[model samples]
Target chain A: EAGVTQSPRYAVLQEGQAVSFWCDPISGHDTLYWYQQPRDQGPQLLVYFRDEAVIDNSQLPSDRFSAVRPKGTNSTLKIQSAKQGDTATYLCASSSDSYNNQAPLFGEGTRLSVL
Target chain B: GDSVTQTEGLVTLTEGLPVMLNCTYQTIYSNPFLFWYVQHLNESPRLLLKSFTDNKRTEHQGFHATLHKSSSSFHLQKSSAQLSDSALYYCALMRGSALGRLHFGAGTQLIVIP
Candidate 1:
């Protein structure tokens, strides 16, 4: 089975610029998640959706970050104004089920650098 | 609130040595699932092993870990280290009540030397 796929494997942007990351999850997966991984750190959950409805987004920066999964299969995460601190890897993951036993499959991740 | 802690930032061991990376977690729920993910350079993190049953050991790819609820720990261990075992390892927790969220620790980098 094909795994989760993400576009623009790397991105470099200046401060105050806007950038968007796209994700295409595995077929038939019902849960999709976006995570931010800073250097030398583990992935931190940013937002998640289940079948086009956002389940949790409390960790998302409301002022600048927004994510949408209109079709329940593909997702887009946007950063309105990027800062240097925003430099990190953006990972997309999907799971066949919501249960804890089903481990999520991860994408290659997009590495973003804000200058 | 759920969180995971991996005390070791870096572990260096010679090939053929036993390996152990400490992991501990805190969660309000008792039946939380613990997972170990390994990420090689330039690759996505993949599941190494996971266990939800307290005190039951789960083994995969020569690595094993047991969820000890009494101690609130799930430390990854291997009988012998291999040069190919060098990678970044992360301990994660999935709350039984939470559907799809995973709380991850700060990760541990393991280096197997010859």
Candidate 2:
């Protein structure tokens, strides 16, 4: 079984630029999540979805950050007009259980640097 | 809301010494799942140990953690530290009702020296 896969392992962007990160969850996984992890800090939940419906996105920055899992198996996280403060690693995780009763498996993450 | 706290920012210990990382959590739900994740350099975070039962010990890869609902604590421990154990550890909590969302601590970086 393959693990969660994320694209563009790394990215470098300037202020006011737009960037998008992609994620593919594990097979048969019903729950997917996106997290932002800054240097020396823990992973913070940005948003999550169960199948095609969003479960929670309260932590997401609506003005600049947006995420969607249209078909429920893949997801895309986009940042509009990025700022220096947006520099961080974006992690994608998935759980096999629909209710997320199991521990999540994480991807290598996309390291983004905004200058 | 659920939250986790790791009191230690960094812990340095020599090989063969005991290791202990403190973790505490706050949550309104009585049944909360606690998890410990380890991330090595340039790697993704993986689950080290997890437990939802109170007063029960969960062990994985020579590391152990016991969830104590009475005190709202779940501390990671190991008898002897190894150089390979150097990494960042995060303690996380998930409310019983809100299963998929995880609230993580700031993290503790453990450096095991020879």
Q: DockQ scores for all the models shown?
A: 0.68, 0.67
Clashes of each: 0, 0
Q: Candidate 2 on B11-87: residue-level lDDT in tens?
A: 99999999999999998899888999999988889989988899989999999999999999999999999999999
Tens-digit per-residue lDDT, B1-114, candidate 1:
788999999999999999999999998887888999999987878989988888899999999999999999999999999999999999998876456498889899999999
* Residue pairs that clash (backbone atoms under 3 angstroms), model 1: none
Looking at model 2, the pairs that clash are none
Instruction: Please name the candidate that would achieve the greatest TM-score relative to the true structure.
Output: 2
DockQ of 2: 0.67
RMSD of each: 1.5, 1.5
- How does each model score on TM-score? 0.94, 0.95
Residue B78 shift from truth in candidate 1, angstroms: 0.6
Error of 2 at B83 (Å): 0.3
| Runs with alpha carbons beyond 4 Å of true place in candidate 2 | A98-101
The residue ranges of model 1 lying beyond 4 angstroms of the native Cα positions read A98-101
